[model samples]
Target: MTEYHGNVHVGGPVQTHELPQLMITKVAVGPMDNNAYLLRCRQTDEQVLIDAANEAGTLLRVIGSGGLARVITTHRHGDHWQALAEVVERTGATTVAGRYDAEGIDVPTDELLDDGDRIGVGQSTLEVIHLVGHTPGSIALLYDDPKGPPHLFTGDSLFPGGVGNTRGNAENFTSLINDVEAKLFARLPDETWVYPGHGADTTLGKERPSLPEWRARGW
Candidate 1:
């Protein structure tokens, strides 16, 4: 709801300090202000970039500071992938995206990720969960640590107050709703933190209370 610099909207600044050991920093990009995340494994200095978008200059600044290892796309949205080639060219890091989105970027995704797949950055590992509603190959990244609240990075699928807009044949709103309710909501702990592609960062518990409202409103 809070728009910063035209495209970047933020409900709040990321709690990067909270995950100090992981050294995770999320940078907002594009006209929609999509988020591209930079995560560094504090112990080994390994890093990864997630969802590279319009803010290449800014993203590079963060990556340069932290040191980048790989680039990973969450879905096929042009806003999220357009600046990716630049990112790859600059960082020399391999790119990973869902098979469907990979072709659009013209880079053979070094790894085609699917549900239950794991992506590791130094010591921290992320679990890939495919939530195929907004796009056929849409995915979310789930990171749960013993010391901190679990985090879910939902790409263009689920947001703070609503779900992503389904503009293509690849989407089925009802099915997406079902998956969010039965799969994501049912499985994740109530205290889990959700950092969506756009809008604010919210908690599973905070958002779950309004599932019925969203369903009733036809989202």
Candidate 2:
């Protein structure tokens, strides 16, 4: 396979990164360029879908006949779940979202997550980290690989350049930045890989130096 640079466009080819026990396939969907991740466990063949953003047909095609075990909505954002209901209906995948944002989504959340909760994917597991401000119930998932570097799936709370947009609310921005700094930057190593809800992927080390700049700009 070609090198996975984590760069994808709405109509472009999907990108995939394989690990010892997991395989992560990322595709750009919807006009907003939302990114949906398909995580499959090599050990158990169980799969999970992150943010069924849009284009149900394409997503279902990618899912194939195997279907999915669970579908996790990153937040309550409309763009993040345009295809959620359909995907769940077709696959019978358990719905998961943050505890606080659960009510905002149209579909019922079968699993409500909080900080420090663990989601099982067959034999593999993902640790949830609740991030406030970008939306009260925003979350980021951590997959700490024993053989290699760690991987993070940040819904809308984090991105490559700075943190996610807080819609000009000073309090929200402050809360978001603080949580990102304390919960994410302060804990994870520089080598951790970050996968955002949209756009390209970035490593924690690459964005660490610019945290101060982001705060100064105050977006």
Span of ten consecutive residues with least summed lDDT in model 1: 1-10
Model 1 steric clash pairs: none
TM-score: which candidate is best?
2
Model 2 residue 49 lDDT score: 95
TM-score of every model versus the real structure: 0.87, 0.99
lDDT of 2 by residue, 103-191 (tens): 99999999999999999877889999999999999999999998999999998899989899999999999999999999999999999
lDDT tens digits, residues 105-211, model 1? Answer: 65568889878899998999999888767877888888877587787888888887877776543337766777788768999888887777775677889889889
- Model 2, residue 10: distance off in Å is 0.8
| Model 1 C-alpha RMSD to native | 4.1
Model 2 scores a C-alpha lDDT of: 0.93
Q: State the C-alpha lDDT per candidate.
A: 0.76, 0.93
Model 1 off-target regions past 4 Å?
A: 1-15, 168-171
